[model samples]
Target: MDAISLCEQYAAEHGMQQKNGNAPWRLFFRKEIFSPWHDAREDPIGTDLIYQQVLHGIKSGEYKCDKEEELASLIAQLYYVEEGPLEVNHLENQIYKYLPIFELKKNKLANEYWTGSIMYQYRRQFGVNPPDVHHVKESVVSFAKCRWPLLFSRLGKPSRNTCTIQTVSGDEYYIKSFNSQKIEYLILAFLNGLKQRSRFVIARKNQCGDDSNDLLDFEVGDLLELINGVCGKELLTETLVRGENTKTCLQGFIQSENVYVLPALIKPNANVMIYADNRNDFNRSQEATAYPQWRFGRDVLDMPLLKKLEGRKEQCNDAMTMFMFIMKYMGDHPSRRNRLSTDITDVIFKPAIAHEILRDELYCQLLRQITMNPSVTSEEKGWELIWLATGLLAPSPYLLKEVVQFLNSHQHPIAFDCLNRLKKLNKGCSRKFPPHFVEIEAIQNRTMQILHRVYFPDETNEAIEVESSTKARDLVCQIAKRLRLRNKDGFSLFVKVREKVLAIPETEYFFDFIRNLSDWAQNINVENSMLQINYQVFFMRKLWIDVKPGDDTNADLIFHYYQYLPALKPISRRTFGEEAENGNLPSHIKNLHMIRKPLTKYFQCEIAK
Candidate 1:
């Protein structure tokens, strides 16, 4: 019989006065209110902590010398009268409830050790519908079977002189070893003292009473919170307490639960205002569509977006897929669409399988539509693609590249449109696709042809010299300081400033001119008379101006120059031609040649006294 029913049976045998004569059994059985607690301890056999105590008391039939009637009276006081009927079959019904059975009988503490306020605290905090204690203990035992000896082995090994583990928040911690015994006691005390508000423990050796080896402790940055496991417990310490504190504090401060609300959900609609200057009415709307919205709320807080989320599931999934495509086409502008990138915990992209989609159907379709439409100007085409690419339907990268190449080869207006699109695309991806992309030579020749026919077909190079001179005069004035002129010798100024300017070719022409000067320095030393005359003849590129004699102001007269200089062999430049076209270089190539030609000549030029 169970505890309550056994007491009732004994009371009946002793002829104890029964109220309502209902077998005194229904007073102690509310299955919902009577669930057992999970101990989270490392024991899986021998005895169940709560049930064993009751079993022992029943078998002994000793109730501190109280008669059966008195013991029955105590049970009645403990449980409600209406619950008496449920107690009659408690022993049979109780069989369904599980309990912890410790595996290690020898080292186990008495049942009393698991009793008192700890049980109450656990129920109040974690809830009454606990896991079957015995089954949980058994599972824990199974988990510990391999770990016990392994843990001891870890303890026995020499301390990791130095080692680190990286946390998800990007902080690395040096794992320090300490005596497990000392740490065990410290943990016990820390748990005991948790009632205090400012609960801080000194982690160094000698902080606690135990004289065992030093314990493990490490620093983590603000991005992540960490809680360590107690010696024998399996609770995720940080997740429980720290997470609770976070929720509680947020609740108190905000008076609402929109703490992690994403901007993509709230705030005003991010509408693209397309003002047509050509149209007489500024208010004329060509076409308008509200951006498909993705609102953030409570569902994504406990789990990431990668989890199987419901409500707006279609929009969320399409947003991600479409956003990836848009990024590949015109480069990512996450802020433009009010989208925030959250860390994806799940593996969504597998490179071996996921092909770049932008180079495929969607991109080609857009290209065709924009190009074949005679009414669409280049500017109109650009704006349309920008809207389309950044919209919820852009394709992936590998496909986008293929589409652009197809457009280029066909030489259709679509091809030119793609070229224009490439120009307008974000410069951040320029490294990914170099300027050599798009068949630049052909594009340049085409551009020059257009300029000749449309802009100045009849003007000879000499005929435009005067106009070009005026332009170059203004240009030289703008770049005088940047050229860093010091000596009257043009060669010295060019040599000094060439590298500064050449390092970034995209800078203004004055910079590009200096860059070309640096590149042509070696060629100038060549003995070819024709090359020298060619240098002087074409030197006055359209931007060059004749500075009249008396109007001098230390002005450095330089011209815009572009050349396809012989590609300098990288190894030759570094090793100063000491290594041959196909020979193993001597070891002294670095150290011994440190004072070689360029270095020696450079230092000599600067330090020549």
Candidate 2:
């Protein structure tokens, strides 16, 4: 007589928020508060370590709670909508923060769906006149109370030797979907009760009748439908459908009239149970994961970029030419040099390697020079030989064995320091060799020497001097600050490359947006001059869902309205006469609006002037 529920029961139990109402899901995260149990008036504990450690553990993916993805989705729904619409697409980054690298890779596509799922919730709260976002679904679950219940019936004794159940309700399963086997086992436990459920059970293909090939993918929906079949104590051979329809029943019977030998699937004395929430549960485990791999960790982070190599790509004087760039850089930094970005390194390596300038032979030649040449062997000019391994040679695993032998037999300080550093790098028994990782974000970048122009919807513009590495949000914030716009969230920077319009992500580099246009335009059949003239950057209101009237005095609100007004598609235009009859005309009419420029002059005037 076992009664068990997995997701539903657990979620309902943990649904209660912390004692402090401001907190979100308890299991999702629980920040520590000063408790009465501890009597120190000052609460010697520094800034709520109890809960913060939980956050850190979860962020690192070391700590996990039941229904982790479900909890993450709930937390994401709660916190993500707090930002503007442009930032909504970037919630994938937030998902990474709360989920493990393994979990993110497993469900890499979840963000594309979930973000839009929660859009309606924010649209209501923010009166968000959101610019067109990528693939937002109309159905929103933000700020809405959700219920997750674990429903189950008490187990009854089997009669006539046919013990089984079929059909299940999908709604009660708190976790909408589960990827791990542990969760599958939990579903089985919930279905059969902890006492009756074994490590696993298999449904016989022959016993399943005509639709024998179908198996439930362990969905709780069909699992619960079994409850409908299991109403009474008398067991029945229920019809188990698959996929859109399904059933669950225990295999406890046998046919004495059939041929003597038992089949391989079921042991002679054991039950021939049939399970499956959907058609693929039996075959699901055997299939390979088709999702994208977004796994990230220490193994993937770029060390040089972390230490230095940001914008230094340009510092290698332009005169070095593609042919001698690597040589000059290596000669100058004879020692370890700062890591350069991939774009810069690719240019240097691609050309040099293509022309056989920095080939395996040249690398081997350098090794021979350092170890064999009489003057070098005598320890004179030893540093110059060591410098030969700088940027280009350091990355390769070549001559590692020879370097080890030289260090073992000889005592040369230059090789001992430089080659040893090189040796320490190649120490691991790696399968793929040195470059098994990507560079991390650089420490910082230099300031740009030029001013960038931001254009408004009305065709007017302002020029702002920003850092070379400034991000989209920073640029928007600068515009908002200068204009005294109190409402900055509704504004976004839209980049028009030729005819294509792209909204720059909030965290992306402002100049990188311009650089990307140049990069992609290289493939176009158009002229370089055409590419340069086609792209224009501007600040405009892309989302007009805001219902709040603009403030007359706040430049922020005025700027927001000026950009937002032109985009109104006018589903229903309210004429001034209609507004007057309705007594609403005075509101906008009272303000002393700025003088408008004629379209002829507006079109000709420089946007930034």
Candidate 3:
């Protein structure tokens, strides 16, 4: 007998004949690359050989490939070049000559519809569209695209195709749509109580079904239908019709039967079961317990409801069962809950729960839960409850006074968080106690001290001359100080002045124009203040910074003379005021505001007389 015949005999003995391991199957090819002709003597029939040959050819530049096209050519040529179509036919004849496996184990010969990994790989290589769950039907069998359903089902065989669950109420839902690996990943990350349910289903290395295009949206109307089915214990033996006009029983169709499966998005109540078979197989509820003995943990033991039970020494199985039911529901059906706010407030924030859980224990658990839940935003109501509760437990202020005092200190990061919240809470509201708010005042004083130290920490006398760097430093300090007092009357006054100028049609640029000039003034050297004005005039004139009536424009010279002059002073405030015994002081002491020329006519007009 030929090698093909011998190989077929071996395959038959090894039980390599089946569609989903049912129909007889045979591996075929258009050609084959002989091992003897290549440097590496590897079995060409094996998947590894096929992969290695394609990869090696591409990497070695033999294929001259770009993306999908090149890969496809290489795969087809590598697998078929040697045997050729005629030789492959001859080999098939020889193989079947000795191999008489049952057709049930030889599904490849049944129809072209039965595709395997080899065909899939070729399609991918050739830029052919890969099949998705949507392409699958009752007659078509395939592996699942989602991992979650697989894990939850835990059957040893691969899934046939995506499942469309039909609710008794005539609603339809499609689970495991295309590229359902993400759904599996999420389920795995947060495995709850359905571990046992996994044993009853098929387990495949592939995901359970496609999730990419799967859409899940339903309403109460759909859920009621499902609940009625479960409550009535209807053993659906026919394909259930769903959507606008589906009407069949759940178990009527056999495996591999040609039909569409529909699933409902609406969550049935706990009393309802989702039927995978005659008895409705319900999904483990999200509200069900995620872990065994879950109530014993810090998350629950410290919860207010638990604390209330603890106070009464009430040890009943009913409470535990109820808690587990809720936990499971939350895990399995997150969308069903109206809101988690009530749950957090009543179950988590109760005073008794607080008393039971140690600060560290509570914090670590909250942190872990939040970190794992990608959807939990800081501003989310649930998250806020968690944040405040956690703060009170671990980072809780040591004393009521510490609440405001620590915020004033800014000695730690927590102080920043506190200040942010405090600012928001007291935004436009007037303070009931000003002088007593020593913490707020202390924080302000601390900021000012830092600025003073940065500018002229050691200068006791006011005769110190201002330097460019010192003036710049003071400007930043002053700006920061103003920002801190954003809630104060001074800031209000600044806003009013700005608004007044902006309100005018032509003078709208007056306040903003001065603010821009202030930036340049800060950069100039004190000794060259007058020269800076000259440059300013030349620059503005070049840019055509002209003002027309109703244009809200101001004279550059005037704005600079008023805004920049007052700002350009000795680093020391006293340099502008103090005088020597001879009545001589800083040369730059004269304010530029004294200049008489319109700001618009700096270089064009005569100097102030």
Q: Write the per-residue lDDT of candidate 1 for residues 1-609, one digit (tens) a residue.
A: 587777777888888847865355555321111101223243333323323433333334321212433333222222221122223245233321212233113344423332322233333423545445355434333332332333212242336454444332235766455454443344334433331222211111111111233222221110111133221121112111211112122111110111111111112122211111122121101121121012211111222132333454543454355334323232222324422121110011211013233223334334433332212132243333433232112234645565556455442443564454454443222111111111222232343111111011112121111110112233333233343433222211111332332222222222123324533653555554122111111111122233222233232223211111112246446765545445645554555434333433332343343
TM-score of each: 0.16, 0.25, 0.23
RMSD of each: 31.0, 32.9, 23.3
RMSD of 2: 32.9
lDDT of 3 by residue, 46-100 (tens): 4344444333433454334234433333333333333233233353443322122
lDDT values, one for every candidate: 0.29, 0.38, 0.30
Using TM-score as the measure, the top candidate is 2
Across 194-257, the per-residue lDDT of candidate 2 in tens digits comes to 2121112233123322334443333221222222223211111112222212243432232111
Those runs of model 3 whose alpha carbons end farther than 4 Å from true positions after fitting are: 1-275, 282-304, 307-384, 394-609
